[model samples]
Target: MPKEQLREAAEGLARQLERQHGVRSSWEGDCVRIKGAGVDGELSFAGGVVDVSVRLGLLASPFKGMLQAEVQRYLDEHVS
Candidate 1:
């Protein structure tokens, strides 16, 4: 994806996270930093590649697979 499209996708994902998971996110330079009761992460886009790094607290660990799937689904929907 181009930088603009990546940024748009990032913003949309941020909104979805906040609305559905109560997480908050903000742009930190070229990435989106996300935080919530049991999650902390950054979503970065560069060289037409998108990367997501997440740290799930103990309370959130059990949902890891689900979270990954959701992120993948969201990216698939928007990045193409």
Candidate 2:
């Protein structure tokens, strides 16, 4: 995808996260901080580059890798 298209898509996903999952996000540089999340995920968007990182606290280490997968599932379903 073109840079602008990717950015637009990233923005859409961010909005979807908020509207559909009740997740809050804070943008810093190209990264976002998702809060009130069982497994908080950081999504970076810049120049058509989007990256995902799901942070499960030390207490929930087992779920660290699951954040992105779960979010992808939600996006696929567009659950609203």
Candidate 3:
């Protein structure tokens, strides 16, 4: 995808996360850094690829797979 489109998708994802999950996100260089409750992560888009790195707290670790799947679903629906 083009850079502008990717940026828009990232921003939309951030808004969805904040509204639905209470995860706050901010741009850090070319990546979006997110944190809230029991989660911390960074998302980067480059060369038409989206990369996600998440760190779940002890209380949230059990839901790691679920979270990843949700993110992947979001990307599949909106980022391509």
Candidate 4:
């Protein structure tokens, strides 16, 4: 996707995360750094690719794969 579209998608995702999961995000250069009760991560968009790295607390780790899959699904539905 184009850079502007990517930016819009990123912002939209951030808003959804905050609203639905109580997660918060801040821009750090080209990345969106995410933090919440049990998660910390960064979402970066570059070269038409989106990279996400998440670290979940012990209590939340068990759902890591599910979270990743959901995020991928959201991106697939919204960012393309």
Candidate 5:
């Protein structure tokens, strides 16, 4: 996917996260910073590549796998 498209997809993901998990996000150039009760992360897109870094606090650690899956699903659905 191109950077623009990736950014759009990420924006969608951010909204979804906010609605579902009460997370909040903001953009800084090509990166989106995300935070919630037990999550903190940044999603960045550059040169048609997307990178996501998420840190789950102790209470959120157990949901790591689910978070990964949701992100993958979002990319799969929106990027292609």
Candidate 6:
């Protein structure tokens, strides 16, 4: 996706999640795409298995991780 699109998606995800708990943290994101990801990767996941297909571009990994963590922290603070 385009950078603007990805940022919008990330913000949208945050807004959707925040609605239930009123989280106020902002969201930031970069363009991400997976290489060599076949159709199988698009399929359903197996038990106890993770399927990370995002490939970051330009933005740092830690930045993304922090954004995710902040989201989770807000959830934990407000919900769990």
Best-matching candidate per TM-score: 1
Q: Which is better, 1 or 5, measured by TM-score?
A: 1
1-80 per-residue lDDT for model 2 (tens digits): 56555545556777776886677877786676776556477777565555677666676677555556766774455322
Please report how far candidate 4 places residue 37 from its true position, in Å. Answer: 1.1
- TM-score of model 6 relative to the true fold? 0.32
Off by over 4 Å in 1: none
Report the CA-based lDDT of candidate 5 relative to the real structure.
Answer: 0.91
lDDT of 6 by residue, 24-78 (tens): 4332223222222111111112332212333334534545575457545643453
TM-score to native of every candidate shown: 0.95, 0.57, 0.89, 0.88, 0.92, 0.32
Candidate 4 vs candidate 6, TM-score winner: 4
Question: Which residue pairs in candidate 5 have backbone atoms (N, alpha carbon, C) closer than 3 angstroms, thus clashing?
Answer: none
Q: Give residue 11's lDDT in candidate 1 (0 to 100).
A: 95
Residue 78's lDDT within candidate 1 is: 97
Compared with the true structure, model 2 gives a TM-score of: 0.57
Could you tell me the lDDT of residue 52 within candidate 5? 93
- RMSD values for the candidates in order, in angstroms, are 0.8, 4.7, 1.2, 1.3, 1.0, 13.2
Cα lDDT tens digits for candidate 3, 1-80: 89888888888888887898799999986799999999999889877778889999999899888888888888889876
Query: How high is the CA lDDT of each candidate model?
Result: 0.93, 0.64, 0.87, 0.86, 0.91, 0.37
> Any runs in candidate 5 off by more than 4 Å, and if so which?
none
* lDDT (10s digit) by residue, model 4, range 16-50: 87887799999987789989989999899988789
| Model 5 root mean square deviation, Cα atoms | 1.0
Error of 6 at 59 (Å): 32
Query: For model 4, which pairs clash?
Result: none
Which run of 10 residues does model 5 get worst, by summed lDDT?
1-10
